[model samples]
Target: MVDQSAPLPSVCDLAIWEPVLRLTPEDGTERGAGRSARVAGRISPSGYSIAHRGSMPSTARIAVQDIQRELARGGVREVVFRAEVRPDGLTTLGLVWPSPAVEPAYGSVNLGVLVLADGSLPAPWLRRPDPVPGAVPAPSADPELLERTLRERLPDAVGATEEEIAAAEARLGVTLSDELRVLYRVAGGDWADDVETAIRVDKAVGCEIFGVEHLFGIDAASRFPGWDLGATDAIRTPPDAVVQGLAGSPGWIGFGTNGGDVFAVDLTPGPRGHFGQIVLLGHTESLGAEPVADSLTDFVLGRLREERPDRRGAELPAVAGVGTGRLASVQAAAHPALEVLSLDGGDGPPFHLAPVAGLPRLRTLTAMPGALADPLEVAGLTALEFLALGVQEWRVLLDAGAVPRTLKAAAVTVRHQDHLPVVPVANEILALWDRPRIAQTLLEGDLGPAAAPA
Candidate 1:
C-alpha cells in the first residue's frame, strides 16, 4: 500500500508509470492461465476508465485496442499508449506521449500529468501564456539644413513667397513635393548675379540656367519650341514655325536652357518617370534627355560651384591682315583639350587660319562657308585623319593637291545658294582614293545616292 497524504511528487519529478491488467480465476486458478481480473481506472486528462473480462491477450495490439475504446468512450480525440514489462511478465499501459499538440510544461509549476503508485491519474497541466508583440516606429525627414544651404549660396537669389508659390501650384493643377516647395521658398526662379553670363558658352554650350523672365509668366511656353503646355493651356508659336511639334504631350515643366537645349522638372511618376526630378535635354536632336539632379535646389547648388576652363595663360601670335587672330586667341583660351575644331565664317569676316603649332593632338577639322585660301596650312598636322569643309574649300584643296596624305576621311557640305548636287561632289572626293570613306551634307535639299550609309 502507498501513502496518499505524503504530498504527491510534482508531475515532472515522477517517473512514467504503466498500468497492467492481470487475470486470476475466482476458483483460485493460476493468474495468467485462467480468467482475467477486470481493470478500472481513469486516464488523467483523457478521463478513460478500463473494464475488461476473461483473460488479458498476450498480443500488444489487442491490449492497445482495449485502451483506445475506453478513451473514445470518455470523449478523448486521440490516444497513444506505451507498454512496459512488469515482473509478472504482463505489460502495463502509459498514457499520452509528448507531441506537437501537447505544449511543454514549465518545470514543476505546470507538468502535464501526475501518476499515482496504484496507477490512478490526476488532472492535466495548464499552458503558458502567449507573448505580446512590439510596435514599430515611423521614419523621420531631414531638418531645415537643406533650405538654409540654398539661402547661403545664392545671397542675391529671389525666392517666391508662400502666396506666389501657392498661386503657381493652383494654376498648374499639381501639388509640388516638399523638396520643391522648400526650394521655391528659399530661391524662387532667378539669380541676381550674372550667373548665365559667367557660364562658359563654348565649353558648356546649350546648358545654362534660365533667367527670371524666362522662368515665369504665361508667355514662358514660347521659350521652348515644339513644347506644348496643354496642361496649363499656354501655347505659343515657335520662332522657326517649320519645325514639327514635339512628340508626346509635355511631361516636364521647363525652367532653364543651354542656348536652345532645355532643363526641366519631370512631373510624371513611374518606373521610367522620375517624378519631381530635374533633367538636361541635349541640343542634338539624336541625343535623348538625361537626369541631372534629384531636385531644383541640388541643380542650382551644383551650377554655382561648377568650374570653368582655365584660359588666362595662352596667347596667340598677332598676324596682320588675317582677321582670325582674335578668334584663334579666344578658341585657344576656351578649349585647352580641343581635338576637333568646328568654325563658321558667317560668324565673322573671312579670315586666314594660321598653322596653330603645338596642337599635336588635333585630328578632325570642320569649316563652314569659309574661304580657306590654302588648305596646306593644316598639312603639318601629321595626326589629322578627318576633314570637313564647305564645297568651295573642298574644290580648292582638290585643285591645289594640298589635301593632307594623312587624311583617311573627308566630308563636304553644299549650301542652298550654291545649287550644287551633293552626289557629284561626293563622287569626286571618292574618286580621289581607291577606297574612299566620304560623307556629304546638304544645307537644303536631300543628298540622294551621295548620302553616306549609316
Candidate 2:
C-alpha cells in the first residue's frame, strides 16, 4: 500500500523509506503528530516481516509489512530501525544495518550492545554466586524419604550409587543438596530402554528428574535469548523473598527440566529461603530463577505453587527505568548497586544523566533517540561496558572526543532521516574501538511525492 519492492540502500531512495513514513503522522492523524518507533525483523524473497509491538490499524499493519518488502527488493535481509517524526517533519531517519552486529535475540526487540566484538559476553554473564555463609537445608529436607518415595513410585527405576554421587560433587566443585543427592541416587535421571521420557514422568515423577552425571551448576548458560537481552539484566530479592534473586550462582545445581524449563537446587538461599529449595529456570527468560518448592520432597509430593511472594521484584530494582508511569527520572532509579539504566522514549524533553553518573556498579546504559539531554555526560559512566544512544547524540560525543572509552560495545540509535549519512557515524564508533565497521551497499532513487492525507 505504501511502497512495494524498492531498491535496497539505493541513494536518494525515497520509496525505500516511504512505506515506513506512511505509518508515521504525515498522513495527518493526531496520534502520529510526533512519535518514535523501534522495529526489528527479517526480510527475504518470501516476503517482509516486522517486530512491532501492540495492535495496529489494518492500514498501518499492511504498511508495516510493506516496508520489509520494499527494502528486500534493495537486498536488505534483516533490519533494525529507530525512527521518529515530529509536527514539523522527520529530521533523522536512522537504520542500523547488518543487524548481526547486535546480538541476535530472535523474536525480541533487543536494544544496545549484546556481545562485544571480541566474542566476549557482558557483565551479567560473568556474575558468580555470592557467598551464603553458614547456609543450611530446610527442615522439610528428607534425603531418606525422598529416595524411598522414588523407589516406591518407580519400582523399576535404576538408581546411582553413593560413590557416583560423590564423584559428581568432586567434578563440579559443588556439593549436591541432601534431597537432590538422594533424588539422583534413587533414579539417576536416565530412563530405561523400555520406558519413554513421557511415560517415565507419568509412572513415577511428575517431572523428568535428571541423573547424577547430568547435573551442572550455576555456570550453566542454558537460556536462548542470547546476550543482548541479558547483558543488562538484574534481579532483586525482597526481604520476604524465598529465593535469592541472582543472575547465576555457583551453588545452584541444575539437575533436570520440567519437560522444557530447567530445574535446579538452590544451595545459596535468600535470607528468607531454605537451604535446599527447588527453583525453576525458565527456558526463554535470560535472567533469574524463581522458587518453586521448599525442597525436592515437595516437588515429588506435588505440593508446589508457581507464584512467588515477591513476584513483582524488590522494593528497588537492580534494573531501573526512567519514564512516564514508572520511576519519574534518573535520580529516582539511581542506587549504589544499580546495574542498568534505560531511558524510555515518550513524548518529552531530553533527560539529564547527571543523576546516575556516579553509580559504582552501573555497567549498561541505553537511551532512546532524543532521550538524553547531553550525550557527553555518558563519558562520566566509567564502569560502562555497553552504551546505546541516538546517532545525533553520538556525533556530539564523537566530535567532542567524549565517547566513553570504557565501552566494550555500542549501538547507534536513530530517528527519521536518510540512512546513508548514519553509516559514517556507525563506522566512526567501530573505528573508535578498532572494531569491524558496518559495510552497506548504497543505491539511489526517488519515489516522487507524498500521498494526500486521508
Candidate 3:
C-alpha cells in the first residue's frame, strides 16, 4: 500500500475534488493566510466526491483536523452551505452570519478555499464585507437631476424663512417628519446631494435607525434584500434585485401607511437620519398639487429635528395635503377589477410586474366611466384582487373587439368626474371580455352610457 506520508500528489492527481471554505462573523477580523489547511479527502479541487487506491494515512487525517479547527475559530462557526450552481459549474462562496438579526437569508455559508489532498492551497478564502451603516445604492454615474433636486432645489426652498415654514404649514395640512423639521430649522433646507445619484448620512449614528420614534423610516438592503430599486425603465438590469436604500427611497414602498400617504420615520436618534435614495413623491403628472411640496418637506424636516439631540416629541398635526384629497377621489373610482395606476415621475412600474412587464403599482387609479376602450395588461396579478384605475386612463377591453372570457367581477367607477356623456360602445365592451352576462346580471341592466357627458 502506498504510504500516505509519501509526498502527497499534486492537485492534478486527484480524480474528484472539493473546495476548502472559511466562515466569518459580521464584524470579524480579517483572516490570515495561515488559516488555510488541507483535508483527508482524496479529491480534485473542482468536484465534490473523492477516491483513493488505499486507506487514508495518519498525516491526511491530521491535516483535515487542523483545517476544521481554523474554520471554526473566532466567531466563525462551520456549517454546510450550498450555492446555486451556475452553467459553468463553478461555485462562489456565500458568507452568512450567526445572528438572526443579520444576513438571515444566508443562515450558513461555505467558506472560500479549494484545498488539495497534499495540503496545497488553490486560493484565499473570501467573504463579503459589511456595507457602510447608512449607505444608499447610487447610480454608477451621477444623476444630474437628482443631485440638483437634493442639493439645490430642496435646500433653497427649505431655507426660505420661518415665514416659509408657517406658510407651508397653512398650505399643506399635514405635519412633517421630525428629520425634515430639523433640516428646515437648521440649514433652512440649504443642502447638496454629496452622493450624486445615491444619498447617505454625512455621518454615522451609533444607534440603529430602524425604530426611532417620530423617525418613521430607515430601510437598508441588508435589512430588506428583496427591495426593488432600479430606475423604473431599468427593470431589466440585474442589479435591481440587490439595490440598497433608506426606508422611503422611492420605488413602491409600504410605510404601513395603511393605504394612505402618511408614513413614519425612524424614532432612534442618529446622524444617518433617513439619508438615502427616495422617489420624489411629486415632480410628475402622477398626482396634481393636492399637497404643496414645500410644506411636506418642512413638516418632515421639523419632525426630524425635534427627535434629535434631546427634544420632546410633538403631536402630529391633522393635516390633509393635496395628495390625500387626490388619492381619496381616485380611491372612490377604484374598482378591484379594472384599475388605473399612477407611477411616480422617477419611479417606474410596480415591482410585482418586474419579472413580467415593467410597471410600478400606481397609488391612484381612476376607472373609466363606461366600456373599456382598451384591454388592460394585468397578467402579474391573479383574478379577484382589486385594481385601482384613474380616470381618462383608457384600457383596451379586448382584442379584435372581442371581450375576455375570464373577467366577471370587474367594475368601473369615475372619481372627481361628473356629468359625462353616455358611453358610445357599452354594449360592444360587454361583448369583449365576455362580460355580457356580467353586465346584465351584475351591472343590473343595459351596458348603457352614463346619463351625463363623460
Residue 335 of model 1 has an lDDT of 33
Residue pairs in candidate 1 whose N, alpha carbon or C atoms collide under 3 angstroms = 19-93, 23-36, 23-37, 36-54, 159-188, 206-258, 207-258, 208-258
Assess each prediction's global lDDT (C-alpha) against the native: 0.39, 0.66, 0.25
Candidate 2 Cα misplacement greater than 4 A, ranges? 1-48, 51-100, 104-115, 196-198, 201-203, 218-220, 238-240, 305-307, 311-317, 344-347, 417-420, 448-454
For model 2, how does the per-residue alpha-carbon lDDT over 279-363 read when each residue is reduced to its tens digit?
8887766667878888888878877856766444653657888886678888888898788888865787788989888788898
CA RMSD per model (angstroms):
42.1, 5.8, 27.2
Model 2 worst lDDT run, 10 consecutive residues: 1-10
- Sort by lDDT, best first: 2, 1, 3
Index of the highest-TM-score prediction: 2
Better of 1 and 3 by TM-score: 1
lDDT of 2 at 121: 56
Q: How far is candidate 3 from the true structure (C-alpha RMSD, Å)?
A: 27.2
- Reference-based lDDT, residue 206, model 1: 25
Off by over 4 Å in 1: 1-145, 189-250, 269-273, 286-288, 297-454
lDDT of 3 at 276: 25
lDDT of 2: 0.66
Lowest lDDT sum, 10 consecutive residues, model 1, at 120-129
- Model 3, runs deviating above 4 Å: 1-132, 135-365, 370-373, 376-411, 414-454
In terms of TM-score, which candidate is stronger, 2 or 3?
2
